[model samples]
Structures are given as structure tokens and as C-alpha cells.
Target chain A: MVTTVNLTALRRDIASLSERNALEAQAPRSAFGFGDRSIDKVLGKGLQRGALHEVFAAQMHDAGAATGFVIALALRSSSDQSPIVWLEEDFAAQEHGFPYAPGLNHLGLDPQRLVIVRCSSPQDVLKAASDSLGIRGTGAVIIAPWSNPKCLDLTATRKLLLTAQQTGVPAFLLRLGAIPIDNSAVTRWMIRSNASRSSGANAPGHPVFDATLIRNRQGMTGHWILQWESDNHVFRQIEPVSGAVVSTPAHRPPQTRKSATG
Target chain B: MRLTALDERAAKAGLFKTMALTDARAQFENLDIAFASPRKDAALLEKLADWCDRYTPLVALDGADGLMLDITGCVHLFGDEHQLRRDIHQRLSQHGVVVRSAITGNAAAAHAFARHSAGDVIEDSALTQKLRRLRLVSLEIEDVHLAGLKRAGLRTIGDVEVLPRAALAARFGAGLVERLDALFGYAHHPISPRCVVPACMVERRMAEPLIVMDSVERVLHALGDELFRQLQQRVEGAREVEASFFRVDGEVRRIGIQAGRPLTDTKTLFRLLKERLSTLAEPLDAGYGFDIIRLAAVRAERTQTIQKSLDSTVQETEEIGGLIDRLSIRLGTGRVLRPHPVDTHIPERAVSLEPAVHTAANPPVEWAPVQHPGEPPERPVRLFQPPEQIETTAGIPDGAPAQFVWRRVRHTIVLAEGPERIAPEWWREHAGALTRDYYRLEDNRGHRFWVFREGLYERGQTTPRWYLHGLFA
Candidate 1:
């Protein structure tokens, strides 16, 4: 009787596991991959479409990097050439400068495909986000609020997520100088600027991001150092130089030992 | 000071306008007097003219105190001319305003009759005979001209009419003949309405005023349907639409919306109007309720009749257009913007944010590519307007900054690229302008910034100042 009971317990576990798998299969599986092998592996199939994703600047000064990362994601996730709507708050635009069209063109985004909705406040940003997310043919929606506002509560984000899911348009909430809080986003990311590999003459090269996946509802969290290849419109993993000589550490061994002792 | 005007009691006491205030007070010891403000009177007259729009769309201000309403073809709606005149008089009286109204075949005759002989509705055949009884002063001519006519012994319009036309023209000037002909209904003088007459309009007049918001929306929907049908019959669409609400208390409220494209769909039109009404800064006040609601296409354009296509792209375009219109109406048109490439080389002026509604109608602009293959972007992702000044320490007088202080934060420059010099446009009148040497800099913390040095290190000028212009990703 003990053997039979153990066998039944094992069968029940298998049954539940299979059921979960089946449910996951039935869920909307339309996703867009990041094209990077390792990042895509960590993201299962890739970032799910028609869901809410939050991107936070790791530091207040890294807002430019965070914005670039979000733009890359939007370009990757958009299924077609449909227009992308950007909901920007007035405070945010004043704090960080306005998005430049020539820069957007340099980043492989057509200026004509961008629709900017300048909202007066954080509340208006969320309102416009929800409106754009409900639109069927919209490529993507990026909601950039200045900072953590009281109106950006869990309830508001949940509403945005539900609307995005219903309309199959992905929504990205970009926060500058804000900490990650509990919300209904499918994925949460913290992004910071990474030192780009220098080209000839010690000049800064392509834009590089140190992106940390803080939360993922359906997959494992990971980190990456990504270099945006604007010409090809893809994110490439930053590879170490093949035959570069290593330089000495800036801090000497005696100084490091004294600090450690303290 | 002279008294500019008088009330009925003061007028009955033999006090005339332009009489000295002391004389008026002497005529009546316990006189009630208030200062007359012609400016305020003119403002009230303008408001009264707006209120009169409920009767006819053509309402113009006559002088400072009178309103000229051309009620042609509108009288039948209010039963007849006599009833229309009585209704206007009764309604205005209810508002505590004493109004004198007259209907005539022409505006000049009507103006004379209303001021000199109140409550006269003259037919086309009787306009001349009726106008002849009015005094020449009622013509509203210049004071000098009126004195000339009086010196010529023309006491009434009858005396002026009996004179020869050539003699009258030669003696008093051609203006008198023109005025006489206008009064006799021999010439037509159309009144310039204060508001633009709509290209097409449909209105609903209710016996009971509508106080509920839902009822107003329902009426708007029906009106939209009617308007769409009218537009469809003419193969036209509305570019600009206006909905006017006539309140029972003589308050006229109008809400206008502009479409990015020629809109022919009734549902989209209703949705846009509803969105605009809901987002109004001052919510619609239904004070005493609205008695008449009219929908008009102020600007209509001829549109091609296109067959419904099976292509999904066409349908998607239509849906997106509708969405743009809805958003523009909700959040003001200026808030909804798209990047428009300008023809200048100045970074800030390179891309201008234009209202999306207008830019959508324009052909897409060709943006010059500023990126180079296998290299980082030449331009920064975000550009600050009027670049912020920064303190910097440079190794050389003209070299890129070695370190910079921005926003009270010190950043050590690790790598930098440029000294791409941009000279100011000398063709334009920009005084005290200097050349700019820009550099792309990455700080030790990996934050990238675009900084510039204004003015070169020349011999006879102030030291060049450093400024942080943009942020790069």
C-alpha cells in the first residue's frame, strides 16, 4: 500500500506539470526575439508581445541610456511599420531634453513613424498610454514620466497591461530617476550606460548599455552588456577585444590592502 | 462733464443726451444718475447680437447699440414676420432689456424704422412709402451730411424722395442717393454677419429644453447622421466642424473641432465631438438647459468616392487617422505632434515639432541621414533648447574639455571625439554670434554628453565659454 501511494503521488506531480505546460502553450505566444542568442535564451521565446514592460534608469544620469534601450526594444518588438506613439510628460521633457528627430533617424527609426503626445502631467501620460495601447494597429507605445508620481500606482499599471493585452500592442513604461516597485508589468529592467568600446584615436564608439533584468514573470532574470548597431538595427553583445593587452590596475596593491584593512 | 446718455425718466423730464450733468440734476432735484460708458454699452450690444443668433445666423452689429439681424427665409420657421418680431421682443424683455425691433425689405430701411419708428413690419411693396415718413436723421449718415440735408430743407425722407435724383447727387453727394435708393428697396445692401456662415448645417429645435447630458449626446448623434448623409450626397467631407448650443437663457456656446483628413464617417465625427466636449476645461453648463442645438460643417472639402478595399492597410490607415483626430480633439492640437524636418543646419532648428493633424496632410519629408556606417550616431538622442552653460577645464586653450561640471556634478572626461566646428549663419541677422566647436564626450562613469565651446580663443575677445548641448545614448 505504501508503494502504491508513492506511485500515485508521482503520477499526480507529472499530471500537474503537463497541465501547466499545456496552459502556457495555449497562452498568446506571439513574441519578438532580441536576436542575441544568450539574451534570447534567458527570455524563453523572447519578450512577449501585447504586454506591459517597465524600464527604469539605474541612475538619474543614465536616462539617455535607458531611453536608447527602450527605443531598441520598441523597434525590435514592432511587427510592422505601423506608427509608434510616444507619450511624454512635460516635466520629463524639461528635465531630459526633447527627443530629436535627426537622432531618431540616426537610430534607424523613421521620423514620420513617430507620433509624440506631450502630456501635461504623469496622470496624462498614463491616460495617453492607455489610449494608444488600445489602438490595434499601433506599433508600440512608450510612456515616459519624469519620476515616481503618485498617480502611477499598481491599479493604473494593471489597467494599462490589460489594455495592451487586449489590443495586442506592446506598452513600455520608461521611468527616469525612479525605483522599481511592485506592478503588473510582465518584465522589469534597470538600465545604465556602459563604457562603449573605443574606436581608433580613443573615440567613443556605438552606444552601449548595461541592462539588468530585475524581474521577469515567465523567465529567468539576467544581465547583459549590449551595443546597439544602428546601421543593422540590432543589439550586439559586447565582445572583448581579441588581442588587446591588459593594463595595470589604477589602484596599487598597497592602497587596496590598506582600504581592505579599514 | 457732459451727460452722454439719459434714462427714460430723465428723458421724460426734458433732459436730452449731451446735456450737462449739472443741468440734468437741476431739471430733477432727486435724479438717479450713473456714468455712461459707451465702451461697456458696445460690449453689451455685441453680447446681445450673439444672443440674437438663435433666430437667424446673420446677426451683425449696427453702430454701438443696435443689432442688425437678417431674418430672410427664417421668419417662416417662427410662424411669420410679425410673430418673429414679437417673439424676439418678448424674449429680450424677459431678460430685463427694453428692445425696439422692426422688419423691412432691406437692412438700411430696417435700421431707420427700428430707431425712428419701432415695431413696424413693412412689406416689399410698402417699404418706400413707410420709409418716406421717417426723419432724415434716422439714416445714420455723418453729422456734417445730416446738417447739409437739413440746410437743404429736407425734413423727412418724403422731402428727399420728391427731389430730383441728379440734383440730390450734385447737391448733397452720391452717398445720399445711395442711402435713399437703399431705403426705397431699389438697391440691395447685404449685412456682413459677425460669424462665418457654415457651408452646411443641420439643427434640432426642441419644445422642451434639454438638461441631461445623455439627451444632448443623442441629439448630436442624430445630427451627425443627418450631416453625414448631406455630405455623402455631395461627395464632400467636413474639414472643420462646429456645434453651437443655444441655451434657454440666451447664452450661446459653440465648440469647434478640426480634422486631419476630410471626415465623412458619422460615428467618427460623433466620437470626436464627444471627446472634445468631455475634455472641455470648463464643463458645459446646461444653465436653464439648451433649447436649440445645431451642427454645422464650417469648412467642407470635395472628396473622392473610393470603393471599400479588401486591403487591410487601407483600413488600418483609416483607423489610425480616426485615432489621431480623437487624440487631437481631447488633448489640444498643439500637444499632438510629429517631427518635421526643417531645411536648416542648426541642430535645434533641424527638426521642428509640428501639429500632427496638419503634418499628416503634408507629404512626408525626406530627412538627411546623419549616421555613418560602423560608427556611433553623429547626433545626440535628446537635444536641449538653448544649451545649458557648463564649467570646464581643458588641457589646451582650444582643445576639447578634459573635465566638466554640469548640473553641479563633476565628470572626468575619459574619451572624446570632436572639434567639429559649426559657424553661425552669417546671412541671417544674428548679432554677437560666434562659432561653435562641438565634441562628443564620455565621462568616466560611461555617461556621454555633447558639449560645445562658443567663440574661439582669438586675440581680442572674451574667453570662450563651454556649454553642454545634448545627451547621447
Candidate 2:
């Protein structure tokens, strides 16, 4: 006799199976960000430890801001004493500039725990990433290849992902000025220079960024206005429309608007 | 081509340097020949000099092919000067490296005798007799001067010794007399050693050469233990430790470790050394094998703690220090850096980077933690290395911008505060230097920025410009 399968029940069954699988593999193979529920929820319980994550910028100018965001993530992952190895391709380092330790330390990521390695090419970057992934006591391994390196493809990223999984180390891949490349990254973030909103008016206030969750393996993609709270080392989501809206040509004066004048 | 060099076999067959290659070939029809590489020979000599460190720590490369060993107080360690020379000769010969070694009270005398009277040991009292027996070539003077002397009936040093010092000085200039004085130990002649002299050193010379990392590690552990014992007896600690591995192939590999604090612990030293070796960019090549390993405490300091200072925070601090040391070693000395804020108003000159391991913010000048009670942070968490130029328009001539465009994104100012004037220090003012009016601005959105307007309207011809100096995060 032929029987009709219940698809919804089958979906439920698979979901439960995955939940049990997570529990089985729950031997300290988990990472959570900043202990903030809002970020943890967005990141699907802290970025899935022992996995590769991608942080990219929409344009070349946003590389600095993207770097800052990535650094924040690394700082969140690493303890004060544990070191974070930042591997940058030679070209990327040239374009984006070297990491300024004093500024970074001011931003609350312990400069003492950050190790910057300049690799000649993307292949060298991947090689260093793979080697650093197995280091047991480090906080995190971060790599940013040249804008679009020839060898920074899905195959290489997949290999890095597997290594991260095996060693229970978190690796962040920064794609400077490049759009998302199809890979096995658990999450992809696109950060740009968003006008920072602050609570106070006169003195400089907290830094704010409009971060878009471009890719999410386990959940839906979303956008948020997040402010990095340096003191607390946590991120707060600011209501987007409430802050200063990025002015378009429509917001400009009549004399200054070229299109309108023309 | 001329025969610039000849081996022992060719020398025995009556061939000498400066002889025509064609004549040498004609004399011995089937003679084996090869090209000469002076660079390679010099490299081999340096390696040999490094190997001689096994005899004494003060071994220096002498000229092109000789090594000067200051075995002054070290001779007794190897029984005596004659025994040390014999040991060096036998060991070098076994390695197929023909060597001539001599020991004497003076450096130049030892160098001269090593070649002319190979394997000779001349006591301080017997120096005169030895100088008399040695040929004029032993002085290592110029060939032109030596030929002049030879033509003048001075075939041996004895003939030159009998002559007045003024005569030799007049004949070959003052250099000849000065060299003779140096050779006879009448003047100072100190050989500059290839490596830095250590403060206190302990060495282990293995009976059998070791080629594996395990043996090297074991040797390092034993040396560390012994060093710590000696340091403890003196109530001192090592700040800098250098390990010299004399490979049997004549190469010397040096590894140095600097601790954040004074250290005399063997285990910690060994652990740090192991980490360093494993992470070395150039792997230690124990080609052939390493027969001698020397550990030197190049810098030492009195231990702060007589006994272990038991404190929870102190332990934590030490652990942090250890981590920094390891990371610096693995990465590089300058890779791991900490920022110490300078008391400056200029945004760019406000901080300096220092090696984190040694200059970390120890309690004294800690940058007052970023957030202050009710006051907004005067400084931004992240400052642009070079303040980025911003397009801004203001209601007042020298006031905060009412609207600013950054990276092609415009933000209308909702609230503004500042015009806090920070004039350039007269002593530090440059051509572009001008009085800056800094403003803290809040856009229609809650976003805040630390922007500045430089040069007042009448003060400079160009309109006051705006800059986004730092991000207030």
C-alpha cells in the first residue's frame, strides 16, 4: 500500500534532528558576541564558533569602517590576554594602511593581544590563516586579502572553514571593497560609512554604523543601526529613522543641486 | 689564467700560488682542478671561528682564514694550552678540515705561530725564543716590505729583532715597528669577538654531536637549570638570555629571549625558548650536528622577589606578561604594541606606541578609562590617522557646521556645540598651522562627530576649512 508522507512533520523531524546534533557537538564549540541578546540573536547565537565569517565593505572608502567593525568582532571573541592574529595581504595593507595600535587600543581592543602579519599575496594569507587556525589559545584569526585576489575563491574558503571547524577556532575573512563571494561563511556583513549618531550634542559621542546582514545561513537577513559602546564593549541597535538620515540630492539647496538647476 | 690558490696536494707536488695554470697543468697532466670562490672560503672560515667557541667564548675571525681564541683563563678548563690546541687540531682534522692552532700570551703572536709553527704552545717567558725561531713571513706584513727585508738580509725575525727599532721604523714606516710591538705583547692587541660578550655564561660540549630537536631541547633544559642554580646563588635573575648553538658544520645559530620581568625559572625559560624555536621564521638547521651549546645571561638584574611573591593579581599580571612575550616573539618585537597617551592637544600627537610586553600601561599613567561619569568623552575612541577633510557649511563664520557632507553622505545638523578654540602651539606651528575651532555636532539622526574648523575668516586668505578628526564611539 502506498502512503502519503507528511511534509510538515518531516520538516519538524529534521529540525529536531539538527537540534540534537548541536547538543552532541556542544563541547565548548560555541562563541557568543558581547553577551548582548540583540546581537546574539542577529548573529544566530554568537556566529557559530569554529566557523568562517565574512565582513566586507560596499565600496573602497568604507574599508576603514569595515576594518573597525571586524576589529570589534575580534575583540569580542578574544580575551584581554589572548592574542588575535590579523593577516593582511600586501596589496590590501598598502591600500587600507597598517593597523594603528594606539587608536585600536583606544577603541578597547587590547593592542597587547593583537598580532599583525603582512602576507605577500592572498595565497599566503590563506596559508597563514590555516596555520593560525590550529593555535589553541589565540582569540581569533582575521584575514583581509587584496580587493579581489585571484585565489580567494570558494574552494580556499571552504578549506579554511573546515580547518576552523576541526580546531574550534573562529576565523574572520574581510573582503575589502568587494561584494559577497559565494563561500561557506556562516554570516556576511556589509558595513559602510554611516553618519554616527550620538546621545550628547557637544562632545564626540559613540560611533555608529549602518550594518547590513547580507547573508545568514540559519536565519533571515536584516539591517540595523548599531553603535559600538567602547566602554561596555557591547553594541546597541539604534532606531534607523530616528538618527540623522543620509541626505540625498533632494535634501540639498536649489542652487547647489546640479540636476535641478540643469 | 694564473693559479691564485693551491691545495696541500698541489703544494706537496711543488705547485705554489702565482704559478701559471698552464704550467701547473703541463707539469701534472691529469691533475684535478676547480674554480676558486673566496666568498665561500671566507664563509667556511667564519663557520670555523664559530666552532672554536667550543674552546672559549672569545673566538674571533682573524684576517681571511685564521681564528683568534683568547684562551687566557679558559686554558685550564681544557687541561692546558697545549691540550686545547691538540684537541682543536684532532677534531678539525677528523672533520677533514686541516687546521693549525697555537696558544700564546699575545694575540698576534698566537696568530703568527699558528701558521709558521703550527701546533706550538709558547709560554709567556718563552716568547722571545719563539720570536727568534719564526721566519720574517710570520709577522704578516706586506709582501713588498717583507721582500725589502729579505733583500736586506733579514730572513728570520731574529735578524729583525737584532736591529734597532728606529731602523725598522725608518725602513717600513711606523706600522712595522707597531706590529712587532703588538706581536711581542709589548702593545695592546685585542681581537673583536664575532658575538657580544656575555655577562655570565655556561656551556655544554657534547661528546657526540646531536642532530635532533629533542637532544637540543634536552641540552637547553639542563643548561637553563644550571644557569638558574647559579643565578639563585648570586640572588640575581636574568633579563636577557642568549643561546648559541655551534653546529658541527661550523655554523652558529643564536636564539635570544627577553623576559618582561626578571626570571630564574628553568621551566619558564625552557618553555619560552621552545615557543621561540618552533615559531622561528628560519628553522634551526642542525646540519651534520651541533657539538657545543652555550647559554649566556647577557643582562642580569637583582630579583625583586626573594621568594615567590604570592598575590592573585601579581600572578595574573605575570601571566599577561608571559603571553605578551610569547606573542611578540612569535610575531615580532614591534608587532604587539600598546599605546601610551601623550599629554598633547594635537589629535595626531596625542599617543605613542610602545612595545606592549615591556611598556604596557602599568598603573601609573593609565589613560583614564574612556568613559567619564557624566561628561561626554573629550576624545573619540577611533581617530583618523590623518584627519579627513569634510564639506561643511555653518551659520556663523567660525562656528560649528550646521550641515556636513562626508563620503558623499550629507547629514543636517540637529544640535551643535563648540567653537572650543585650540590654537596651534607657537613653538610647534608650521606653515599650515592655524587656530582651530573644534565643534561637537549631532546630526538629525543621533550620530555625533568631532569636527573642527581651522583658520579664522580674517586670519588666513583661504576660507576656514573643516575636518572630521575623530569618531566619538
Best by DockQ: 1
Q: Which residue runs does candidate 1 get wrong by more than 4 Å? A: A1-28, A240-262, B37-43, B158-189, B304-310, B361-363
**Candidate 1 local lDDT, B378-455, one digit each (tens):** 788888887999999998887989899998999888789989898888898478888889999987667889899998
- Writing each residue's lDDT as its tens digit, candidate 1 over A1-262 gives 3444688889999999999999767765579888888788878899988999999988767888888888888999885478899999987877888887788777777888899999898888888788788888788999999888999999999999999888778899999878888999999998888777887687887888888888999889977878898877788877433222223366843222110111
Compared with the true structure, what per-residue lDDT tens digits does model 2 show for residues B37-60?
899989888878777777777888
Interface RMSDs of all predictions? 3.2, 5.9
lDDT of 2 at B451: 82
Candidate 2 has a TM-score of 0.68
Candidate 1 matches the true fold with a TM-score of 0.90
DockQ agreement of candidate 2 with the native complex: 0.14
Error of 2 at A47 (Å): 14
Q: Give per-candidate clash totals.
A: 0, 10
Task: Evaluate every candidate with DockQ and list the scores.
Answer: 0.50, 0.14
TM-score for each predicted model, relative to the true structure: 0.90, 0.68
